[model samples]
Target: MTTTGATKKVLVLFSGGQDSTTCLALALDRYDEVETIGFDYKQRHAVELGQREILRQALTRDFPAWRGRLGFDHLVRIEALAEMSQSAMTHDIEITLNEQGLPNTFVPGRNLLFLTFAAALAYRRGLTYIVAGMCETDYSGYPDCRDDAIKAMQIALNLGMEARFVMETPLMRLDKAATWRLAETLGGQKLVELIVEATHTCYLGDRRVRHDWGYGCGACPACELRAKGWREFKASPSA
Candidate 1:
């Protein structure tokens, strides 16, 4: 399916954070109509999802012109993994920050499950594209978030559903610095800053102090990634 003409429908797995929010902006520019689905997924910090909705509301408000052009669609929630609760994502395990390989916070098969659900919904709605915020470069290193995994999932999704759905990863190759650059180009630096400021990325869900770029608990993989990216951004402002 060629998305060459007017108003291609795009479905974004929005988290209302810097990466996903930037992806959302990119979708708006490319697609004719954009609809977002933010999943709660029984996460320890449900506040992230709340921040997602808050962003949807804020974006629709700011761009009142696209109030109808956009879609928050719905904030869906799914049950945590039942059997093994070793991960803080599903059970009461403590989610750590800055460890090394795949922290306990890594929800097993999360992106896979979320994409499956989102793909099923997109199929039902006859949408042709789906977007995610996962990035391998400058990442906290979640194996599932890699482009290879996404491609594999896309193949599986198509074979399973017998439909062609392109999973767009605008931030796939780009590190945090490149993401900021993309956002700056697509939505302006201030807009990107607003996206960072308004959204929440802290795993702990602490929105206490706002950074020049956005909110952070000054802890967790997400915070570390954001801060690292900000340092990169500061080092290369033009980017």
Candidate 2:
């Protein structure tokens, strides 16, 4: 459980979005070895997988010290999960508010499954940490993004696997604006710019349009939150 004076290895549940990219930067800064894993669950925003690869290359080029230490970038195909889920993120349906007032984009059991699989992968690879970017603030009302849910999932994962794997959620309480600030603090202005330019957060999967915040369709919940966060961040003294 303790990683003092020893090489700390971590597996990041990367999604190639602004939040996850920031988490990756933080992992690179804190851990001795870092590897990233992304899920392909046939989501509408499949472009994120490509963005993950692009960011990985850019990170490797910018932070050459992580060249060898950054282990293999694994992209797991879980299309069966998508087929079983009926969320707007996976199915070709209009996004709406569910009866529970949650966004239709909420995929049930996604974070749970993702962490479980990541924990297994980490155990097999001799890693003891799993990093994720789930945030409760400025989010789309996804229950899995909550801190308590993640904590329970972490406990469950450890108990189920009989491993002491730590699940790290660096953005759990961070708002979008605060997330931007964290990235800037962790990797400087270059990283902030990289995220704004390269990361994908649009649920509609529209990348042709560019905004001061990032690329998105500008109407989806994800884009609205990102744009609002960028505006607030820019107005704050930190910007």
Candidate 3:
């Protein structure tokens, strides 16, 4: 899982949420050099950008040996995209089922744009791998989170860039419970605790309320799924 080139570097599309933080831990474990990038797309949960920095600093402090191995943390500001889309995530709208039966939280082409930007950053930095945390198992009906969509985007990105770029989705098939297990496997229980306490995932963007699963508004779709996963994982014999 190590990088192929001499730099041994990879770019991670990190949002400082549960899944992407786990992806960051995975990247650090596999690559000699890992740089994380976050987007400030004017989402409702803009607090995630702050969480990203917190996790970045925590990783450096907790894993001192990985100080040099962990590279830059880029927070790209693209608020124009938020202006162009209407979603519960980026817009102050009601959370309800759309006409397509999808949740209003599904931001159109968010992952696609995120991955594309990550690829560009990786290309500029002489890195070939772009790691993301998009998962089909717990995608919550986001079309862009599907494995087929990722494969197609990978092909298109490689073709457009005219470079052999690897788009790695480590959690593409993992459910929330399995993702919790992965966090433990990557950095043990401390990492799990960090994710639960520091990551932001509420569609309502409320962090004041804390739960066993994490901090969120508790009633949002994101919170419900996360809580359900945590409960299931904790009840399991392995957990």
Candidate 4:
């Protein structure tokens, strides 16, 4: 969707990961004003939380065009969400699929709650769009990340808040490799390098060893997907 005039503003659901970082870049490119919001749910990879500020600083420092458009960064603490889940992401446990076939890393109602809170923040901030990094093409099988779920959330938020808020998920259909290509398309190799060096996606929160894709334990689902995508992206003819 095209946005113009004062309404060309967005609030990104940024989590300092590759997907959210790419989405942030896209929002800055497409919108006149852009704000970001992150959550601290006391996850295992809380290190990702720390990377948010560093990534924001790098974006404004390296990309001059996005500097003025980038606005406030809001962080919310909802520890109760983690307390309600005993999943691997919320606790120190194995990242395995449960009997229902969904991975234990799936924190139930995460995206739902995130969007609800984000819509509320956007309402107060006078933002028109809510951009997120949720993807279903190459994900851990989280139901909330699906397109239909996002659409439903948009309707619910708009109806509940009595405001017209558009939800944009740029990575909804793109896989990990395509997501990397999107980063390059948005900000060239500089953005890709920034993502590799700065963004954190490992579920285990291990950053000691640095790989081409970034720091991770290399065994968790997150790292594996990132590694595979990086390799595929590098192998692509255009890359």
The numbered model that scores best in lDDT is 4
Candidate 4 residue-wise lDDT, 129-236, digit = tens: 999999999998999999999999999999999999999999999999999999999899999999999999999999999999999999999999999999999999
lDDT of all predictions: 0.78, 0.88, 0.87, 0.94
Q: What is the lDDT of candidate 2?
A: 0.88
Worst window of 10 by summed lDDT in candidate 4: 1-10
Error of 1 at 115 (Å): 0.6
* TM-score for each candidate, following the candidate numbering: 0.89, 0.96, 0.96, 0.98
Tens-digit per-residue lDDT, 16-131, candidate 1: 77888988877776677788888776666667776776677766676544456686476667765434445665466566643555687786778888899899999988888998
- Residues 84-153, model 3: lDDT tens digits: 8888888898999999999988989888898888888888998888899998888689999998999999
Name the runs in model 2 displaced over 4 angstroms: 1-3, 64-66
| Tens-digit lDDT string for candidate 2 (1-239) | 24588789999999999999999988887788999999999999999888998898888798765566677888888898888888989988998999999999999989888988898889889998899999887799899889999999888888988988888898887898898899888777888899989999999788999898889999989999999989988889978
* Root-mean-square deviation per candidate: 2.6, 1.5, 1.4, 0.9
Leading candidate by TM-score: 4
**Candidate 1 residue runs with Cα over 4 Å from true position:** 1-3, 64-68, 82-84, 90-100, 237-239
**Candidate 3, superposed: residue stretches over 4 Å from native:** 2-7
Residue 113 miss distance in model 2 (angstroms): 0.7
